[model samples]
Each structure stands twice: as C-alpha cells, then as structure tokens.
Target: MQLASNKGLTARNDNPLFWSLRNAFVRGDTNGLDRELRYSFQSFLLRNKFSKSVTASHKKLADLRYPYDWFPATRAMQRTIHLHVGPTNSGKTYHALKALENAETGIYAGPLRLLAHEVFARFTAKGKPCALITGEEQRIPEGTDRYFASCTVEMAPLNKRVDVAVIDEIQMIADQERGWAWTQAVLGLQARELHLCGEERAVDIIKAMCARMGDKCIVHTYKRLNPLRTMQESLQGDFRKLEKGDCVVSFTRIGLHTLKAGIEKITGRRCAVVYGSLPPETRAQQAALFNDPNNDYDFIVASDAIGMGLNLEIKRVIFEAVTKYDGGGHRVLTVPEVRQIGGRAGRYRTAAQDIKDNHTDTTSRPTSKNAPAGMPASAGLVTTLDDEDLGVVQAAFTSEAEPIKAAGILPPTFIIEQFYSYFSEDTPLSFVLARMREMAKLSEEFQMCSIVPLMEVADLIQEFPMSIQDRLIFLTAPANFHGTGQKQVLKVLARCISENRTAHLLDIEGLDLDILDIERGAADVNNTQYLQRLEELHKSITLYLWLSYRYQGVLTSQHLAFHVKSLVEEKIKDFLDNLSFTVEGRKAKRQQTRLLVERHRKLEEKILGDEPSNEAELVQEGPGAWSEEGHEEALMEDEAEAEDPVGLPDAIREVVSDDRLPRPAGEDVRT
Candidate 1:
C-alpha cells in the first residue's frame, strides 16, 4: 500500500493530472486536489466502458447454438423444398435435373466434379447458357450475363438468388469428413425451389431441417424402374467365365488391376478399369471404352467409384469381395454401398433414346418437372466372384441403412475470424482450432465437423509466419501432407506464401521431371511404387491449380500446371490400357485360358487366403482416418511383396477407405 515508488505506480504518478494533484497536496491546495481526483474518476469510467464492449463482442462470437441464424438472407426468403427419394437407376436425379433445366435461373450442385461436368456438357449441348464451377476449374460462357450454374457441392454460390436448385446425393449429409458442404448448400442456397435427390434414408432429417426453417417440404418417393435379382451361385474364382457385359467390383487398386489383367489374359478380350484415385477424366474415358459395343473392352474392372452418378451399361455386377479396408481397419461394406454399386448393371438405353428422339426440338420439349414420370431401365443381376462373398452381398442387399440423425457443421470463416481475434497473434493455429471446436455449443440437430485433418494441416505449416486469415486459407487448401513428393511441394508453396512471394510449380526446389514421364514396361504398370508416384504427382499438380484459383496472382503457374496435368492423365490412361497379370509360364493360346485361370486362383489364395465369416461383427460404418498401425502394416506388406515373388497375405488389407478414391482437385484428401 505504501509502494508509490514501484514502477507501475511511479509511471501513473508521473501523469500531468497526477503531478497536478501531487503538487496541490505538497502545497496544501485542497481545491486543485479535488479537481484532479474528479478527472481520475472520469478516466476510470471511460476505460470500464471500453472493457465491457470487448466482453460483449466475445460473448456474441461464442454464441454458436443457432447456426441457422447465420444465413439471414436465406431465412428471410420463402422457400419450397422438394425431396426426390429413390434407389439408384430410379430417375430421381433425372427428374430433379429436369426441373433445374426448365427453370429460368438455377443451379445444379453434385457430389463430384465429374457429375458437374456432365451436367454442364448436357446443358451446353442443348444450346442452353450454362457455366461450370468447381474448385480448380471454371468455365463461363461468353456474353452470358444470365445463365445456369453446374458446380460441385462445396462450390455452390450461396449469395446468388435462383429460381430452382438441385442438390444430388443428398444422403451424403451424414458423411463424417465432407458432410458439412452438403448441409451448408441445403441451408444457405437462396433458391425459391430446392430439389434434393438421394435415398429415402435422408428424408426425415431433411424434413426436420425444413420444419425448423419454416420451409414447406414435399417428398416424392420412387420405386426402381427395373427389377434386380441376386444370384445364388458365384463365379467360383474362375476369371475365364466372365461374360461380355460383366463388371467385376473390387475394393483396391491392385485387386482391380489383377482382375483386369487376369481376365484379359484368359479371355483374349480387353477390360476397362475405374477407381477413386484415377482422374475423373480417365474414369470417364474407361467407361466410354466399355460402353461402346464395337470396342474390344467388353468388361469393366472397377471399385466402388461407379456407385454415384456414373452410368455404365453392364449386364451383371460381380463382387470380388464383400470386405473392404476402410482406412481405419478391415470392415464389411454397408447396405448403401452394396445397393449403389450393384445397381449400375442392366441400363436401358433404347427407352431413353426413344424419349430423346421424340423431343427433337429442345425449345418444345416437355419439362420433367411437371410431366408424368416414365419407366427407367432393365433388369440388373448381382453375384460374387467367390462363393464366400455371395452370402454377404445378398444379406447386405436385403438390409436397410439406419436413418441419418444430424447434419454436420463447422463455423464459417467470418465466425472463425472473430474467434481468432480473441487469441494472441502468436498462438499456435492447431491449438486455436482445437479450442474453437471444443468451445462450440452445437444444437441437437447439428454436430461439429471433424477438425482432425485441419489440425494436422495447421501443425504442418506452423513454422511459417503469416496472418491468421492467410494461415486459415492455407490450412483449408486440399493438399497432401503425407510423406511423398507432394508433401515437399506443399511445404515450398507454404514458404512462398509466408514470404509474400509468387509460387510456381516449375520453380519449386528438387522438382522431379520423371514424375511426368511414363515408364514403359508391363511390370511397371503393376509396380506399386511406380503407380503411387504417378498418383502423387497428378494430385500435386491438381492441388497447385486449386490454389492458383484462390490466390490468383500469388500462385502464377496455372497454365503450366494444367498442361502437366493433362500429360499425366494421358500417361495414366496408357498405363491402364497395357496393364496385365503375368505368371511364370505360358503355353498355347487354347491352353493359356485354362492355365491362367488356375494360376490366378493360386495367386489370390497366396495374397488373401480364405475369406472370413463373422456375421455379428460386421457393424455399419463410415469412412474414417487411417490408423497409423494399419498404415505401417500395409507398408510392411508392400516391402514383403518386393522381397519375394509370392505376395504377402492381406497385401490389400488397407485400401483407400473413402467411398471414392482420393479426391480430385477441389476435394479434400483423406489423411
């Protein structure tokens, strides 16, 4: 109490008003001392007011219990929601898309860029003014001020008002990693009429959302246009018996290639392949090859990538195995996965062609929004490659998936920016993100989106000095941080941004030119190391282009990155075309078919052994982060295969667990 000589007290006492009061005290002047004391009291009141204002701001940013109120513009408008609920091949998307086509101004938001491209192409072919927008790519028609938009879900324009909107694969609202995008589109899109197309499982959840918003919800249920039957007998592990219109579905890149090579070797017919990691353009090219009847590619060797919006003309669906490695661990496929993949078979082209023929003039065509619904396709057949998988596939087809309970959500950028202001400038970003997620007060209808990947990304770029806003932008960029050449490129880009310099892919340090070159050999096609490098390079270039769009002048190598990406895709296609499974010996052509089938069976046994049958343990699951132990185990298996010709058991134990393979340019990669 007697420490007026202390540094803090001495500094305060040195103020002019304090000096006046002290001088008055020393001279015994009571009037001057009272005036100085009044001045001090007024200063205290003003400082307290400013402190209260800051406390109020903090409270406002902390109140996140009502996320629906964030989008005030959307809430003020009267909206009508249409739910197109049906199984695959039931024309749900077709009808919803038709409504979008008829509207004066509308948007089509799909789960994949491939689907967005397809819709954009269709609208352009019909001579409609349309624009395509994805994370990495944007195409705007010349001289068109008013036009339709086709975009991926995450790229949907929330600020623009439209007459109609269509959101495909609405059931994805429950996805753990990316579901927030779907939920955001549904809630924030300023549309007079919004059409949501997907399975019936999403109906109740969406209706609940609409009820909260006071929007009218109307659900249209549809039955499969064609019959589908599960076969009792499997292929009995015989690749020789695969027919012309068969699609053999497997869960791994190696497994699909093995099937493709073995079938081509034995049957003397070419096979096309599709998976998640392959570029969407590459997947489309393969599908086109298989769909053309005159082509030598009479069969498809694919992963679950065919499940969503990819229309293939196949007579039968053959399962290589019912079990899949879902990043975290080995798990059985869920009911939705089995149904969606199995439903790609038996497309009815002639019926759709008949309708197209009747409507020769696009201007005079009847809109599907109000027209009566028509029949869709023909009967689709489903079976298994081995007897062990048949029972599991059949059971999955008969079962139903659990209904969704809540939509995923994350704080908007502005909300995050305000929250960041509460922390010191030097606080670690990972810590800030974790604290925000923990402190968030979520409503019962919404759950916090996974921030693990964001946190991981924050840790990777913590060494770089940047503003909080700039740091967030880098944190959200869809770039790989895994131990690969791509990770090196990502670090370089971060360094450039931190230093406020331009980034160019070609100018990056230790850049490998060989990644763009194709390795010419049959063995190289099956070489895991070679294929992984190719995929990594392709994804890295794509990530560069994605950032260039956002950063514009800062990342100035967009043109070169685009050129390299196309070249890489072509190399990938060439590699897939020449891929084949080879054995130790080969005899005459007639005997080759028989001998190859036998060897293929032996090869499979050596890799996967017999399938397991623990029915009770097959829990319904979603994609999750790959466990470190599982990834280490897979690396060890890869090493074993390189050391010995006989492959390690469970070599394909940990496939990329995403429903689709690694995402393309605009999409986030699984950790």
Candidate 2:
C-alpha cells in the first residue's frame, strides 16, 4: 500500500499542541501527561461553562418575561428611556440629539455610518470634544476630556456607563437584517437616559419591551417641520421635462449608472449620483454638489439610500420602478419605503428661505397634501413612471406599519462555534443560526440575529485549516464583496493572521510608504478594473484600522493605516470626479481635495527640494509586478494532487467541505 503524505496531517503533526500531546504519551512520567490533559481540559471547560450557562438561562427564560435584562451590563440599571417618535424630518432625532449634546458623557449610536459621521462632525465642530467610532475607523482626538462618542449601532460600547445614550432610527429594531444592533443597544446600554428616535410605528413595541424590562418609558411625538406632498400628476417616463431639482430613483447599480449617464447625456446637465455602493466620502461629495444651487450638478440620481438621513432639497422624486430585487425575488416597494423616499421630495428648507405659499399636495386622497399634518409647506411633489403602482404610493400614508417583536442578533464568533459544535456533523450552517436563535431565547448575552452573513462565509473559512482566532477574524472582517477585490485582500490578511502577525503596508511587498507616492495607484485607476482594486485597497486600510483598534499593542500601525486611507480616498475621489481629465492632469491635481492645494504643492516641493536635481523625491518603485501569495502554494498542491494528494483528518472533514482537497480521478469535485 502506497502511503500518501497528507499536507493537513503534516500540519497537524507539526502543531505545538500536537507535539505536547505526543510527548505526554511517550513519557512514562504521569506529571507531563497530567499537564497536557489539564490544558486541554481548561480550554474545554471554559467553552463548556459558557454553553451550560446559556442553556440554563434558556430554561429559566420560559418562566420569566424579561429575557434581555439578565445581562450583567444592564442588571443594576433601571433604564429611563425617552421615546422621541415621529415621521422623517420631524425633529425627533434633532431634539433628542440636543439632549445628548447637553449630557456630560454620552453615546450616539446611529444605524448608518453617514448618520454617525454627521453627529460626529456636528459635535466636534461645536468644540464639544467628540470621538467617532465606526466599524472600520476611529477618530478620537488627543487632549480631549470626556469626549462624546458617536458610533454605528453595532459598535456601541456595552460596558460604558454614560449620562445619555441616543439610538437613532429606532424603527430599525423591526428590521430583519439590522434590528439586532438596535435591540442590543436598547437592552445593553446602561445610560441614565436612553433616547429612542424614529417613526411612530416602533412606539408601542418599544414601550412594551421597555415595560417588560422594568424600565421607565416616555413618548414625545412631533409634527414634520416642512410640508411634503406627492405630485398630482405622474411623470410617466417623460425625459423631456427633466429639470434641476428632480431626483430620479432606481433600485440597482446598473439602473443608477444607466439612468445617470443617459440623463446627463440628453439634458447636458451634470448629474450627481448616490447609491449604496458609493463610498461614504464620495456620497457626501456628490450630495454637496447636488445641494449647491450655484453648481451645474442640478439633477440627482439615487437609490433608496437617499430616502433616509440625507436632508436634500429635492423638489420631486421620480420612481423609475416600484418593484426591486429584495435578495430572493423582485418585489414591490413596501409602504414604509414608498412614504420615506417620497417624503424627501419636499425637504424642510432653511429658515431664511420661506415657502409660505399654498401646499403642493397633488393627489385627491384626503391626505394628499405636500404639507404633513399641522405643518405648513411650500412646493414638494412625488411621482412615479408606472401608474399601476401609483395607488400603492397613494395608499402608503394610511398603511399600518408592522410592529417590531424580538430584535435580530449575532452572537460573538466563538459563541457561534460553541453552539455549532452541538449539532450533528451533517448539519448545515442554516441550522447553526437556527440553533443560535433557540439558544438565545434562554440568555441575554446569547441573543443572535439571523446572521445570514455568518452562514455565507462559513464554508469559505472551512476550506482552509484555520485556528479559531483566524476563523473569527475572517468572519468579522467588514470587507465589501463585489467590485472591490476584498476577497484577494482578505487572503493577504488571512496569511498574516496564520503567521501570527499583523500586516502593514511595508510588509505588503509592492506597497510604498513614501508620502508623495501618489503614483501607487495613479496608473491603475485609468483601467475600468482599477476602481475595484482601489476600493479593495481602501477597505484594506480600514481593516488595518479595525485590527489596530482590537489589538492595539500587536497592531501598532494605525497611524500608517490612516495616512494610507487618506491617500486612497484622494485617489478614489479624483477618479470619480475627473473622469474627463487627462491622466497626468488628474494625478497632478489628485491631492487638491480637502482644500489643501497650495499646501500639497508646497509639501511636494519641500520633499523634492532636499533631493538631487535629477531625482524625484518619493519615486521608490516596486519591481512593477503583482503577485498573490497563495498561488504558488496552490500550484505546489496541484502537483501533489496528481500523485499523493493530502486530505484532512476525518474529524474536521466530516463537518467541513472536502472541496479544498484534491479529488480522485473518478470522483466528482463538488461531492
């Protein structure tokens, strides 16, 4: 029998723990054996204890109503919650935020990064020390005392005790995708005053949940400040009448691009586009362009992304299609979505610019007034191309919004694994989350959201033999999947993690650290695919910042990461803004963003000033080649696959896909 030299088995043999265990067996001394057993036992015991506590918690939950308050973070705290409820632009959040601003120590958690950033910028500019903590970036200034913190809801600090905690878009607690973050924030935040801000739909459910948790809840309802009314007449796809304050809505990326390009080409007016895929920097810039009355970017093309948080002065919102792909299938826009996006058409204008004229409400529906109830308005209109769905839009005002039940949840990665271990080997990842849900019912700490993403990448991690820590890093990495080459970027990160180190730009082979190295992505951005690469690099910089925040001591290169982030942001902005500019001109003016043109030129001259006349200052180039680390390893494995292919141990192979291993000549690759 020919014995195969298995790669996985070889790795297993070389592991330090494996050697320790082997030594215990070989040595006749009982102490050595006992030492190794204790290490293993301790690890298992820690995990097992967590499992038991969660299981017991679930059993007891059946007898109690307050499943959320059991968490140690919230145990001593009898939360005093103030519910600021109203429609969009009703000043609910604005007033709630005023309360947050007055508090000595506070946390403002918003559903979107843009919203958190707005709060961060507003607070910081007001000279009130503020720290911005999103998933990928941390902007905490030095020498600031008791700084206010603004963060994405998922990044909300559970342990921190604040004078006030503000949760924006509280209606999202009913959202199947992100509800858990709102839920966790509401349940875990130990604030003296917890402020929930959103529409009236979430009011009852929030009150009920707070009541059950034994917290005091109060409701503060407000009327919209501006008059927002749907148009009496629909556009019906008439491109001839496209005007300056018109925002055309599309559902998908292709739709946004096509509509934008076509509208700009026909109307000869620059169109500012806003979609979910655009980086937050680009989105803000585009919005600024559209908002400026003096600018030629009069027309706005956007997705549902423009519906929330963006206070735009859009005179009309034209829906291209009422139906959109909601992951599974194409479906009509929900009543909430229709109303929300339509409301943006007639935005609350500034105090100086008054619209004291008659309301612009067009439809004959009793509620069809451009002005909201009890609020005076000017001209604001919402229309659609397809008249068949006009009735749906018309009926949106009276549609009863759904009540939020339990919040969605995603337990920490290790907890996910522990719960996963209990299920049979043949069980799918779907069941892992299903099991998590059943388990969370028993404990506050274990509350898990549907966690579809956890399932999506589970197989990808399983493909490689990785440590639990490595698996967790990959799973939690906030890398964008499409267009961006984040998958390749992730591979680089995985290799560094496997080697037990953090990656820096210096270690990335081709990356240059010189401040004036704008040529790094200068050439590539010309190609269509370069945008994706640039996006990936941008995301990679964020990944570094994220890791630095997590393990600050081990990954002490956050400063370098921030510098790179600025460079990449400049490159991306230049590429998007100056599509018509010559490559050389674009490169020369790339650093002109952020109002630093003269300063950038002076810095460039200074760096080159000390160098020889013939030499450029920061032109240290890579060998001008791109290489992926795993390619060589895969090639070597391919050679082995033809002869003595290695396979994983049955223990792991039973649960994980054996697809990573080479298949036999007659065997199906997938199976």
Candidate 3:
C-alpha cells in the first residue's frame, strides 16, 4: 500500500538516510558499522511488522502502533459502510440481511451464538454454501465450498475477502466487557460493503469511527416498523394476572425459577425459562415452545439473557424488579438494556400465512418464515413490576440510546505471549493478562485487537512447577475455579504435550472415574446434588472444545469428549424439563438421603483406590447435601482448602471433590 513517487529516483528529502550511508561508505567506515547500519535499514522496512531482540538492549517498538497497518486487506479496501439505525421491531436487520443475501460472498457477525447459527442456517438453506463459526462450535458442511459465513463477532475472519459483511448490535461497543469485539470489527473488518445494525444512539460514534478509518459512512435512520408503546400501569408484582404472550423478566436464577414455579402453580400453564447458563439448544427449544401457538408454554420467564438479538412475539414485557444485583450491589438497568429487552415485545413481522395449514410447508425455510404466524402488528407494551421504575422504562420510550464511550480490547495472543516470555522470571501468573495489556498499548499494531476475554479461567492454576506452556494452556481454558474436572484436564494436557499425543478421558490415569456417573449412580438418588457436578463437567467439556479450536490437530480427542458431553447434556436436559427437587424440611430431606450419601461415599473411595487424597478434595456428603443451596454450603465447609491457585503450577493443582472425607483405613467415613 506504499505510494511510489512518479520519478524513479528517490527525492532528496526522502533519501537523507541513503546519502548518509553512502557518505559513511565513501569515508572508509568499518564493515562492521556498515553491517549494523544495514540491519537498521532492515528493521525500518519491517517496522511494526516484526520485533527482534537478539540479545538485551536491542528492542524498540516505534513502528508497531497501528492495528490497521498490519492487515493489507484492511488498508486496501475502502469500506462502504451503511448504518441501519433504529428502534426494535424495525426492519434494520432485515434490510441489512437482504444486502448480505444478495452478495456473491459475505459474512454475518452476530452477538449471540443462537443468532449466528440461525443466520448460518438461513443462508445454507437457500442453496448458498455457508459456514457457522462460534467460539464453542464450528460447522462447515461436508464437500461444500463456503461462499459466506455467519459467526459471532469474535470469530469473524479478518483475512478473508468478501463482498459484504454485516455487523449486528453495533451499539454494544460501549459495553464494559464485550464491547471491544464490535470496535475491532468496525475498525478492522475488511469488506467492500459493511452493514452496521443497531440503535440510533451509536450512529454518531460509528460515523466518527468510519471517518477516522477512512471509510465512507452512509446513515439510514429508521422508525420502528411496528410501534411499541409503554404500558401506563405496572403489574404490581402479581403473577396470577399473567396470560399468554407475557414475558416476565427477572435478573437472577433463583427469582426466575421461583416466579416460573409460582406462575405454573397458579395458572396451571407450562412456562418457558431462558437464562444465560442454559445451552443454546435449550434456549431455542424454550423459544420454540413459546412461539408455537399450539404449545402449552403460554408464558416466558427469563433473565437479561433475552435482552439481545433473540426475536420473539412477546405481547408484554414485565420487569420483575427495576434494580438488579450486579455482583456488588443492586443497580438499575441501563437505558440501552431497558430498550433492547422491552423491544422484544410486539415484533413487527409475522409468519407467512398457511405455513402449518393450507401451505403445509415443511422445508425448514427459517424462523422468519415459520414463527410469528399471528401477531398484533400494530404496537407492543413494556412494563415493570410494582411500578419501581415506570419513569425509567418510560424514559427509554422517547429518548435516544446512551452513547458508547469505549470498546473492549484484547491484545494479540502470540505477540503478548512472546513479550511475557522475556519477563517470566519476575512476572506472576495472575498478572499475565494485565502485563500483556500494558505492553500491547506500547506496540505499533495496537489499534483494534485489545479485546481480552473478560472472564478469569479457573482459579489460576495452583502448581507453578510446570512449564509456562502448560500453565498458559490451563489459564486460557474456560475452566471454573471450583470445578472437579479441571485438575484432571491439566494432567491430561501436560501428558499430551509431553507425549506429543491427543488424550481421551480413558487416556488420563488416576482420574476420579466416579464423575462418569451422570445420574450420581447412588441409592436415594438426590439428582440435585449430582447436578452441581454435572454443571462442572459441562464447563470442563466446554474448555476442551475451546482448547481443541486453539490447538486444532493437537486435541483430536475433543470429538470423543463431545460424546461424553452429550450424555451429560441429555441428563441435564431431562432434569430441567422435569425440574424438581424434594421440597421438605431440611431434617426430613437429610434423614432420607443420609444413608444414600453414605453408600455413594464408600463407592467413591473404592473408585479412588489407594491414591493419596489431597486436601483440595470437595466432599459431596455431610450436612447440606441435597439442594443446590445445601451443596454449596457443604462445599463452603472445605473453604480453607480452596486456596487461590495463582502460584502453583497447573500440573499439581488438584480439583478434588469431597465425595468422601478421610476415615480410619478400615472404618467407614462418618456420614
């Protein structure tokens, strides 16, 4: 992309360094000095493109500041960006998708995995070969040439050439945690025609970004395709008055479950629950139940998980409370979230007539053509419980969206990792990411890719005795701090790296095989206690999937691991479908389940055999071993053992569950 001068010879102003070098050579300067000068010239050519630290005191990062300069594709393409700005129920995304559909080659980057999968399905169904790429899953049809791809924004391929690229939810760039992806996409995505879809509030920010990036920006302001009106009155915390097409929004899992159970108990109607932890498949199934007119799922109760690109025909949105417990304390929902979730009610479009009846179309054309058969089409309503924030909800009714101030940014994995290698002697494992950011800010190629994975993976691997590579692998895996399977996963990864082989579950020795029991494999059968373990296992599987993507051919066992994941998922799915637990007095429930937990404990000891147990073992039995509350309480009893594993090497950091505690060699563990 460097512009060349019309004349063959370099201009005198630009050739000052060239002349200086020539004069030195003419003056009979030492060959060693000439060699050093030539190396400097090589460094100038590479600039930020590379870094070389042959020894100490030789590294300078002056030429590596701009992220856009790294990508030839980004530099060469003049973006034709169309901003589809509007409120919910508007055809903003519809117009954007139409352009993508008509393009010879394109990509659609969505916020949610469900939305990305849906778009991928839609394109592939229309006889266009498409790829679906998400962080957890990737699918490219067998023996097909992909011309388009639908993926989460983080997975958007920057190097590929395409006619069009659709970046959805452009306003999320202001999000404190995930907004960096949208910013990176806006600044770095190399596409001929870029469609940015989101609320009107982001219009100005996007225009400024486009101008800075040297891309032509076209603003398309739109009104709601279907009107959405705020309800004058609130629900006053009443669940009995709820009917079909009502969406009750709660912020916590406990509250959502309690509300859903109460609603079902009173109205004798099935309810669909959508929460973040629920899998994409489960969420889709729940939405399908609510969308189908004939289904028993008359009402929907969900968390803020429904606040994004999910489309549903909710007649009314009832916020259970105005304030949410945001980790630290209760806080009011932001104006943008209020609008995004509220807009789900009364979507404009409807299903094609005679889809299930006169037309009898069974071709799976897409949800757009299948769902929303009957709708009011005119207006929607957004309300809250107890009138706590009626004014707040109403403010979003007319006000523009809140402007985004900053985007999230993660540094390049390889570059920052290399930087850290030079400082491993003094650097603590806990601050690896923090240090990477500081160094990345100093780099020349630091423009867009600063969006780091916001969540911490595992309680930083405790065993520091292992190599940096092993520790880093564990750090990067999306592992739960208290997960039982993480220790084994680390062992397996170490073995794999050592042996230069992929590992399956059976391949790892000394693993607590008792976890294979998805149903707890015990007598009294308190499935609730087993569920905690299952959730941990699910997270472990997710870590494997993520690692497999990073290592590709190195983790060939991921496909087999998925088979085990399916078994665990089936148990989870069935349990959630018939969600229940013994709801009796704590004394009564424990009395009935005590003998059961004891039997399970003895069986687990037999499984562990003679292996010396670590203090880190998480005991499943003891007081509070039935409900999720009790399970957590039981875990808390071993709180002293759950030290933050920041200093230990990943190899020795054991995630021992107290399925059993120590007893005399011959005596049964006290129940």
- Better structure of 1 and 3 per lDDT: 1
Which regions in candidate 3 have their CA more than 4 angstroms from the true location?
1-65, 251-258, 274-286, 294-296, 323-330, 350-377, 389-392, 395-401, 421-433, 436-477, 482-495, 498-501, 507-529, 580-671
TM-score of 3: 0.67
What are the per-residue Cα lDDT tens digits for candidate 3 across 1-671? 02112432222233434433432332222332353365445435534433355222123222234544545668678879999988776777877987898899898997766578667756765678888887667887778565799987778988787889999888766553345567678777778999999888677767766766788999988786655778888866566777677898865444455567667876889988876556556766887788777778889987665665566667788876554433212235667778888887775332222222322222222233212335343457788765645877988777864454334445444454565565545444444443333233322112222122221332234333556565566554544444456556655665575556766655655343355663533565454455556656665666667777777666777777778778776765555444322222211222222333334345444643444422111111111111121011122112111211123232212211234444445432221
Ranking by TM-score: 1, 3, 2
Where is the poorest 10-residue window by lDDT in model 2?
617-626
The candidate maximizing lDDT is 1
lDDT of each: 0.66, 0.57, 0.57
Prediction 2 TM-score vs. true: 0.64
Clashes of 1: 1
**Superior by TM-score: candidate 1 or candidate 2:** 1
lDDT of 2 by residue, 258-363 (tens): 5676677667889888754455667668877876777798788887756656656677788875655342222356777787777777665421121122223322
TM-score of each: 0.75, 0.64, 0.67
RMSD of 2: 18.9
Task: Choose the strongest candidate by TM-score.
Answer: 1
